[model samples]
Target: MINKMEAKHLDFYYKDTQALFNINLPVEKNAVTALIGPSGCGKSTFLRTLNRMNDVIEKTKVVGEVLMDNKNIYDPDVDPVELRKKVGMVFQQPNPFPISIFDNIAYGPRIHGIKNKQKLQELVESSLKSAALWDEVKDRLHDSALGLSGGQQQRLVIARVLAVEPEMILMDEPASALDPISTSKLEELVRELKNNYTIVIVTHNMQQAARISDYTSFFLNGKLIEYDQTNIIFTAPREKQTEDYITGRFG
Candidate 1:
């Protein structure tokens, strides 16, 4: 399988405290890879490292490499802003920009120099459709995003990310705050999206990981305990720690 992203011996530190240790993995293209672990096990921290989201923290440092398309993203010549545009992120919470639903989806294209009104409309429509949110909000394009339900807002945030046309999407506990029905919708979206975009999702819900991910990586205490096909990871995990965690022995 072709890899869309990779991390090699990656270690992350926040000032004097370290978070991730010597991580190495390949993120396959057009597939979903799930990261699972207890809170603060470095799952989210490792996710942030992919697009240099950790760079915003003061006195933080990354050691080793994170490569995209075989090019090291951590190279001194790389521009984080441009890199992020190609590797969009969906946060744990739906954070729409307190604007009209249409404008929220159009924001990325407009920022990237797409000035034509017709073009913006087309992009917004396509993006919203891609995010599975078009039908509900198509007529209310001018409506404030905050007026929508939590689930719609989350999908809008996803549509906003899709508007940028990124090759990969990183989600950090994306459905954690949604109702069961909404979470189901988001999972369906994630499964469908993997057909065209590489995806890495950090999720606490084991069932969610099993249902949507092609591969699963188990992390513990800032270290990778196991990585394998989802079926094997959940059914016959090789590591004792992984098995224990998956079998309700311990976190």
Candidate 2:
């Protein structure tokens, strides 16, 4: 499979403290890859580097290359805005815009200069349908996004990202705050989405990662300890640290 994104000897620093150390990994195209480790292990930090989301952090410095489709995302000529458009992100908590549901999904296209109401309506419907949310919100297109349930809000966020037609989706513990049913729905949605988009998720739930991901990368203290097929990583990790971490011995 083609590599959608590659990180080479990546290291990150926040002020004087080092957060990531010589990390390297390739995210496969059209597959769900899970980044798993204990809290503060830099999983989220690593996810941010792919789309240059770390660039906005004050006093933060990043070393090495995050190459997307062979183009260095950190190159001086690379536009952060455009890079973000190609790589959409969904946060741990559902953050819907304080506007009508239709406007929320239409925001991306509007920013990119899509002005036709009919075109926007089509995009909204298609995106919402793609995210498995159109049916629920179809009747409430003009309703405030805040009025939706947690699961619906998260799906709305997904639809918003999809509206931009991003090549990759970065999810940072996307279902962590949801109830069991909602989380299951989100997981099912992720499975369905991998057919069209490359997905990289940073998750703390080991079983969730094992259940949904095609590949799993294990990190410990900012270093990649293991990268393998989901089954191998969970059943027979090569590194002792990975084995220990997955077996509940230690992080």
Candidate 3:
């Protein structure tokens, strides 16, 4: 498998408290890799490290390398903004701009300097379609995005990410807030999205991980315990900790 990104001996700290330890993992291209663990296992911390999202938090430090396309993204010269553009993020909650749906998706591209009206419209249409939201909102393009359902808002946030043309997408428990039906729809969307975007998702839901991810990494107490094929990790993990966690023996 072609690895789109890799974390080598990665460690992170919030002030003096260490949050992650010696994480080494490969994110394969055009596939979904899920990070699974209980709360405070550092899954989200490690996810943020991928695009330097942790940089926004004061007194936080990262040690080791996160390589993208074989180059260490943590290198001094690499711009976090540029890295973030290549690796877009979606949070646990959907956060759509309160503006019109058309403008929300257009926001990123416009920031990146695409100014023509027709081109913006095309991007808006295509991005919404890619996110599986165009059919629902195509006629209501000028309507306020905040009026959308939670599921629609989440998908709209995804469309916003797509508008920027990211190579990789990071998701932090994206389905946790949705209803079962909406969660299923999001899962289906995730399955479809893997054909084009390399996705790394942090999910507390083991079932969700099994359903959507090609690879699964089990983290505990801020350390990586096992990383393997999803089926194997679910059925025959190499480590007892992984097996225990998967079987609900302990988190």
What's the TM-score of each model vs. the native? 0.99, 0.99, 0.99
User: What is candidate 1's CA lDDT for residue 81?
Assistant: 92
User: Which stretches of model 1 miss by more than 4 angstroms?
Assistant: none
lDDT of each: 0.95, 0.95, 0.95
Clashes of 2: 0
Off by over 4 Å in 3: none
Off by over 4 Å in 2: none
Model 2 CA lDDT for position 125: 99
Clashing residue pairs, backbone N/CA/C < 3 A, model 3: none
Return the lDDT, model 2, position 72. 88
Residue by residue across 1-251, what tens digits does model 3's lDDT show? 99999999999999999999999999999999999998888999999999999999999999999999999999999999999999999988999998999999999999999999999999999999999999999999999999999999999999999999999999999999988988998999999999999999999899999999999999999999999999999989999999888898983
